[model samples]
Target: MKSTISLLLAAVTSLVVGGIVVTTPAPASAASLTEVANFGDNPGGMRMHVYAPDSRPANPAIVVAMHGCGGSGPGFYSGSEFASAADRHGFVVIYPSAQQEAGFGKCFDTWSAAAKRRGGGSDPVSITSMVTYVQQRYGGDPNRVYATGSSSGGMMTNHLLALYPDVFKAGAAFMGVPFDCFANAADYPPGSSRCTGGGGANRTPQQWGDSVRQVYPGYTGPRPRVQLWHGTNDTLVPYALLQEAIEQWTDVFGLSQTPTSTDTPQTGWNRRRYADSSGTTRVEAYSVQGAGHSLPSAGMAARAVAFFGLDGTGTTTTTTTTTTTQPGTGACKVTSTVNAWNSGLTESITITNTGGTAVNGWALVFPLPSGQSITSGWNATYSPSSGQVTARDATYNAAIPPNGSIDIGFQASHDGTTAKPSSFTLNGLLCATT
Candidate 1:
């Protein structure tokens, strides 16, 4: 998506340049079987298989689920319990396989792009192309398309969000790569992998952070949202590092993130609440204080269903915990810089977490004046009404630790720069630029 770099409108226009707007998937009532389509070659000219739901109607929602390295759809399929849901919900469930790397069937070159290779070898694109094929065969909702994956697969989900903003409406990442988990030059290039720094010193790594700043919701009604889950005992991904990611996201959204005195400790779990200003999306760090590299049940599957407006049966618990009230800091300065293009501008925002503890699971709420409108954004979400503004947590910006700063940017449209809001209040608190 970061195909170009310019300050004016051209900069923002580059966001949607690589977006492949194919036909929507068929409705939920025609195709009722796991069908595979030939998506050309699989790196080595090998054809791939894609599973489609039966009874697919025109304009149906499509979800592409990827397996972790050395794992395939069958490996993680039954665990997610998605096939039955796809059949009942009328949505398409795609199971894409990873090519064997160095004789092992457990890898996707996520570090290639960030490592300065061609922005190719993109598994997300291959997955996207698969979605396009489905859309061409059966009309589906281009906006509601979703994604999910295991360890490496989950990292791919973040890669897709950074590289392809206009692709999905929401995502659910399991005990995989958290936001900003990868940062290194010479390891990742534009529109490629999300794990850069982790790729090592074998070569120069491209900056995924730059790509994260560049690619995101391209005026696609609103910024994409995500529900994230990770076990505290996740030996693979450190809990403290995950906390940093959550903090970064919350800072960008400028939401209040405070560690409450109350800590609910279960047998092997300690749950903390980081609520968004709107109180819809909650960021709960379920630390398996005693568990290890596994999910809190099939939380990934449950979250996926809940985010898609599907029946979240047997997933969500019966108990409803009261959301803690977060005190907001006074109004701060808000500065907006738009790289105009594609009938919108690239919005760069800086917000401060003035609350006592920190801000987590937050959102940015700002009124969009007439003549100027928000087409899309990244980090934070924007859903504007006539005058009132409503927005929430994006995939990346869901946590902000105390005194931490996060910059979230995206695309918007205005007749002129003067029409853009001079300042904005995130989650009901005003934040001005310094």
Candidate 2:
């Protein structure tokens, strides 16, 4: 049933770029879940729960998983697939419970003036406190912290990223509205139908972005990357808000509203990716056809994990290119760069198909140096994580057109030596290197 909520014109567009494919599961780790009675000052009166894998890196990434209205931290922890993903990718998960308001049914604050301002107080502060606590106690990577949620929790996802851009690297909000979409309704009851029922679609992208900028005036730091998901059939929170959200984030990223690429990564999923000149995707929106607020069907969380780069290493900088190769007949050029630290390093390998034909469904094979093992990666999947590793293409990057190159990278731990791989092969054929 369509929502009776009044809405202005919502321009929902579907631009297809590539065909759909399924995702492969990453490696796995066991998990231990727990609850913390005292995390910090209970500014939002939120309860804290956490999930950590049995095996974790010295410094692991952290993800704050919030629940919808009437939901609790423990509830979201058990119901969401993020914890299992943390097990597979080896990260920390912080679940925050929103205390019940007289008329709000335990929804995260997204409308009030306090919730809109940075450090103004509300669920955002409480959630950030939980993140800080995790960082201090578990050695979580401060630079790799992220947030994600569904429904009301999803609205808070937008709020947290807008208010704490320096604190969160990226966020994935499923079925969420734009930041500050509900600000005008501060005087209205909590969970007012005005915003959730499609009344907030009247604002322009610039106006929406301005709302976020106003939160942290004069702060010029990098805005957090955002991933938005919504169902076309959503009634409670009308689907129109999705477009507004895309507009808001695209404006925040200073990118054109036009998507760099569009595709159906999965059947019924119309995905739009907004990237900058460097081809780094800053915003991604998934529109599920004929679906509702109960989005994030099977395997959706995995997509969020990939988008968050949670399946890969921490921040890295290019230091040295170890190998460079030229293209020949059916031959490919491989360039590898390394950024080394104390015991771990991030390696970025770019494969260029210099041949006349496209290389499809390819796999690159190479051996890791002794005592070196991969912990996480992106753009491709690595197996064995150690000696004689195979890097296979992800569903979205399964092909490299002629004269085109794709960059794939991973983070690894080493004993000491940072020796480069002596040789590389693509689909059993030898590749050239410099």
Candidate 3:
């Protein structure tokens, strides 16, 4: 949650305090700050702050976190506790500061036509360049990258996800307007009535998605997974916009408007999951029943990390090997194949119970190459530490009778060189990896 400041906080010149630079209100802390002058085409400049673990892992995941209007990167860093999560999860977080050059108090210029078009303007291109710079300099995984933000930053998150879908595997937007909600900067910060009225009040879901499709025309590749978080009582960005966001993304993913499943994981939170026919979750929305205009400090960040498959602790490399199972034992045979590969890699693994008896549960342990990192997965609990990966079945897929099988899939990023694992072990017994 970035610090929300009044509109009067906007400034014409950059403000520097204790080595921390801001374009709006001053941030509370100034640590590990690095400023990128003349970022992209924007004359106002951008500031970046990094939060890396004590011992960085090989090809670690990277998250590009954006601050809202009138907010500083350092302010969001402290308020969101993303640095602590990075320290615990062995990932790298980059906070990109927004400045008040557009008369909107350091807000992202999301309402502009340039902001809506891919590679046509500075904001999206500059952010993409920042991600590339971090990945090249810090050994961040190119495939496992993600973006997230609140308010204006949240709108930019949607912009990035739609324009650069190949660059980010997933994104989360909090209390943001739909993509291309406004055509001109003069209509910036649309009032509550207009916001709730819907960005495309008369357009169909396909039409809304077509707006995104036009950004990267001829793109027939996989779309990024989406997560939306909004407070029911949000007045700044009305809660009704959530439905529009859902509609837009559903069309983008070619999913039905209706959710596949809806559940209350905890009190005051309603979660809806949208999936494809294969049961792969493509989109999720969380609505805080009574909350308003704020980030969910309790579990939002951690939940996003879990969803991204980077929750494992530490940066140390560990290796463990198991002996081959005997013929009579109830062994689980595993086979893995690369379903797709590009800037990232998506692989599918099938585990078959070949023994005579049923197994109550299963776990697969394997080694990932130094350049590979898991970004998102389905039908399994994936935990990766350094070069090792552990995959466990979900509750519904835990039981496996004799001759039964279950399939798990995950998306991973590599440094242009992808190498499949040579071997796999299920429950401490070696299974042939082919």
lDDT by residue for model 2 (1-434), tens: 12321221011101000000111222233455688888886778888989888878889999998776666777666555676678657899998888845243567888777778898887788898898899998999999999998777788999999999999999999888888877444422223456765555578889999988988889999888899999898776788889999999999989889877776654457777888766678898999877765644445676788788775642212222222222221268788988999899999899988777887677676757888999999999898788657788897988789999999999999999787775565653446665
Pairs with backbone N, CA or C atoms under 3 Å apart (clashes), candidate 3: 99-106, 100-106
Kindly provide the TM-score of model 2 when superposed on the true structure, using C-alpha atoms: 0.65
In candidate 2, which residue pairs clash? 17-262, 324-434
lDDT per model vs. reference: 0.49, 0.74, 0.68
The CA lDDT at 1 in model 3 is: 9
Q: TM-score for candidate 1, please give it.
A: 0.52
How many clashes does the backbone of model 2 have?
2
| Candidate 2: segments with Cα more than 4 A from true spot | 1-30, 102-104, 184-192, 313-434
Reference-based TM-score of each model = 0.52, 0.65, 0.64
Q: Once superposed on the true structure, which residue ranges of model 1 sit more than 4 Å away at CA?
A: 1-37, 40-48, 55-57, 100-105, 114-121, 179-211, 215-221, 251-289, 312-434
Instruction: Please list the residue runs of candidate 3 whose C-alpha ends up more than 4 Å from where it truly belongs after superposition.
Output: 1-44, 101-104, 192-202, 312-434
User: Which lDDT tens digits does candidate 1 get at residues 70-92?
Assistant: 55554444444455457545677
Candidate 3 Cα deviation (angstroms), residue 358: 36
